[model samples]
Structure formats: structure tokens, C-alpha cells
Target: MAETKTHRVTVAQRALLLSWAGVTDLGRRRETNQDAFLAEFPLFVVADGMGGHAGGEIASRSTVERLQAVVSAGDVNGPAIEKALEQAVGDIADHPETTDEGTGTTLTGVFFAITGDHAQWVALNIGDSRVYLLRDDRLVQVTTDHSVVQELITAGKLSPEEAEGHPYSNVITRAVGASELTAPDYVTIDVRAGDRFVICSDGLTKELTDYGIQHFLREHRDPGHSVDAMLAAALENGGRDNVTLIIVQVEDEDDSSSPIEDTTE
Candidate 1:
């Protein structure tokens, strides 16, 4: 039910422009993959599905597909983006194929654009899947998790360390298609030369430490290699959940050195 105007995205006047997505099946326990992802011009997403049976896959796939279609049709800005996300949620809630407790999905998406001398980016999400900005050697998480533990941390009811091992650590308060509609938090960032962006699912974050992520990004330098290192670290730790990752780099046209380009899924 999501609607939007059709618009074509033109190439940016930058030294590099590319997108990428990676996914792993449900780790050690589950027999099937429940996570879904997408990457294309101007858009990237990672969805973690939740529900019993195959409903998890349905929720994640539905959210990603609807979001991609709407963005492909040019839906944007806070209001349009919000509506499109709600519609995606509605689609999952209304899905006839869903056989389990109404399915839910964690969605995080990034939209990129270049206009004149400025490069713009938007990060939006409805659950714990995250978007991060890496500059110089510091890594900053741009999206907040909607989990109960995160809320407790925000409300000062629990310390960061205690919340990590809390009983409700995995309980998210909001997710796509879990309710009639869902609202996602949105943040716009000014992209600069030498900025690297990453969007990923909880699978990557659950196993790898933030320092581990920063170290890989700083040391590997290559987007593909960085993703590889992150995944390798996660698999080594246990690979307990479905993993998805997308890496993007921003550089000015004059940067003498070039970075490897990684295409999307």
C-alpha cells in the first residue's frame, strides 16, 4: 500500500559511489535464514525477521521489498519516508501467507544523494539494526535500538554494562509489521570526503565488539575487506544469529588514492 512518485537518481560528482549488502543464514540453531536485505542506488536496508515458523522470513522480506519499491518510486523526506515505512509494516501485518504469531521485522535503511557541492545521507530504522559512521578512526552508531534494554539505558534505569546482560535484552519495543503500523526514527547527516558508512543487522553487533568494528574499518580500509573481517570475527565468535552488512565509502574527486568498490545485493 506504500505510494510514491517515480524519480530517477543520477550519478554523483564524486570519486566513488557504490553500495553493498551481505547476509548469513540463521546461525548454529535455526535451519533456515530469517534475515533479508537490499542495496541499490540511493537505498540500503537490513531486516531481522521475528516470528515462529517461516513468519520471520516473511516479515523481513516483506519489509525490505516494500521499502525498496517505495524508494525506487522516489518517496523521501521525514513525512513520505515515515508513511512508506508504516505501509511496509501494514503489509506484513496484513500478509495472508503469514502463519505464525503476527510477524515482525527490524528495519534499518540509508538513503544517499549528492546535490551540487554537498553530499547528503539519511538513516532510518524501526528496531536494533544499526547504521554507523566511521571517520578518521572513530566509529559512531547513528541509529538507536528500540529494545527494552536500550530504553532502560536511555531512561537511566540500568547501566550500559548491566543492560547488556539483562533478561529483556532481546525484547524490542518496536518493529516493522508487528503492529498496525510502525514509525521509524530518522536522522540526516552531512557526508564528507573520507567518510565510511555501514548498515548492518544485530547479528554482526551481537558478536563483535565496537572496538573490533572500528579496528577492522581502520585497518582493512577496503569496504569488502572490512565486511569480510567483521563477518569472520562474528563467525569465529559463534555466528549465533542471521548476519547482514552493507558498506559505503565517501571520497572527494581529488583524493589521489582510490578505494575498492563493493556492489550491492
Candidate 2:
């Protein structure tokens, strides 16, 4: 078993702590893992690629690499991310592996930003990969899927249950490198302690339900353990596709106080 990698960052002004862990598995059926992720502070992302013959792998890896470079340069805002994603698209489109097959990848994750005295969590999504939030003991999907089945469900033509089993469930309407320009949906939320965020590829959700994920998160308080449990559950269910997940846990430093006692004992 390999050791899980963890990254921890702190918001200096507010003493808010953010810790994250990421895992990517080839799964039980895939010949190659086309999923890529970034778990660095202020920037975490998950990219699930499409197209076969290693095209997907190249697309996804290129997307994450571009984003990582942008983040390392200190541009961690919505517009900066969008620009990076656009460049990533061009990079993948120009690659030899994807030039003919037309490869693309889903990009989704959260970016931490601080403005004045307020700290915010920025959620970005494109395609079927998802971002979820577990707060107040409730787990809810933060990003909406941009897929054929998702559109049908929105139009009331299909129920969530039916859409899950639909043959075209994996047909995403939006993805990086799929077109000339790709605009991602972005939402900013106020950061709070005890807020747990999960960014993952569709492979994880396909195997585990929201309730199942929430149960695992609630059972494991540590981000590393939570990620391990969730990934294990997904593989156990049926590792149909490449599975990848990132778990971010926010904490308040002030909440760790302990009572003082007499000096001599």
C-alpha cells in the first residue's frame, strides 16, 4: 500500500486551516488511467478524460499540468483559472494523440481565495466530473453535470434514477479541448469550519451514491481516511472507469483550545 499524500494550507488572517488529500486509481477495468488531479493549496482540481487509445490520458494530464503551472504563478482566481483551462484545451488539441481522435477532459474542483477579511471557496465545473460539499452533516453536489442525461433530467423528461441507467449518461456536452473556447460554471461560497469538500471524477459517483459517500465521510473524520474509504467503496462496488477523488477539510485553529491546569501535579 502506498502512503497517501496530504497538503495543508492556512488562511493567515483568519487562522483558518485547510487540508486536502487526493487519490487516483486505474480501477479494475481500465487499461490506462485518464484521470488527473491537483491537491496543492489554493488550487485543487480533478480532470477526467475522454477518447481512447491513450488520448484521454494525454488530454487529462495536459489539463492538470497547465492548471498547476498557472497556480504556481500565483494566479488563483476565477478568470485566471478560466484562462488556464482555455490554454489547456489548446495544448491538448494540438497534441498528436488527440489531433485526430478529438480528445477532451472534464475539469472540476475548488479554489481558495481571500478578499479583505473574508475567505471564499470557488467551485468550478465542466462536463460530468463533480464537486460535492459535506456541511452540517449533509452532503450535496455543488456542481451540476453538463451531459445529455443531465439536460433531459432538467427538462423533466427523465428522472434522476432513470438517467443513471441511461445509455447516454456519459455523453458530456462540455469539456476542455472539445471546442475553441470552454467556459466553466463558477460559484463562490464563504469558507466555514467543518466544511468538507469532495472533488471527484464521474467514476467515483457512478459506483457510490451520495448517501454512501456521506456515510463514509461522516464515519472518517480525517481527510486521508475519508478519501481512502470512499475510493475503496467505489472499487468494491465496481471499478468500471478510472476513479479519482480529492477531499478538502476546513478547520478553525481557535477551536482547538484545551483547559489549563495547575502547574504542579
Question: Number of the top candidate by TM-score?
Answer: 2
Question: Which regions of candidate 1 deviate over 4 angstroms?
Answer: 1-16, 19-21, 74-80, 99-102, 114-118, 256-265
After superposition, the stretches of candidate 2 with alpha carbons farther than 4 Å from their true spots are 1-14, 256-265
lDDT, candidates in the order shown: 0.73, 0.84
TM for every model, in the order presented, reads: 0.84, 0.91
Instruction: After the best TM-score superposition of candidate 1, give how far the Cα of residue 4 lies from its true spot, in angstroms.
Output: 29
lDDT by residue (1-265, candidate 2, tens digit) is 2234444444443355567788999999999999999988878899999886878888899889988988889868878888888888778777877864458889999998766555678899989999999978888899999999999999999999999899999898888874556889988877677888999999999999999999998898888888889899999999999999999987776653221111211
lDDT of 1 at 59: 89
Poorest 10 consecutive residues by lDDT, candidate 1: 1-10
Q: lDDT tens digits, residues 127-189, model 1?
A: 888998887667999999999999889999999889778899888888876564777888877
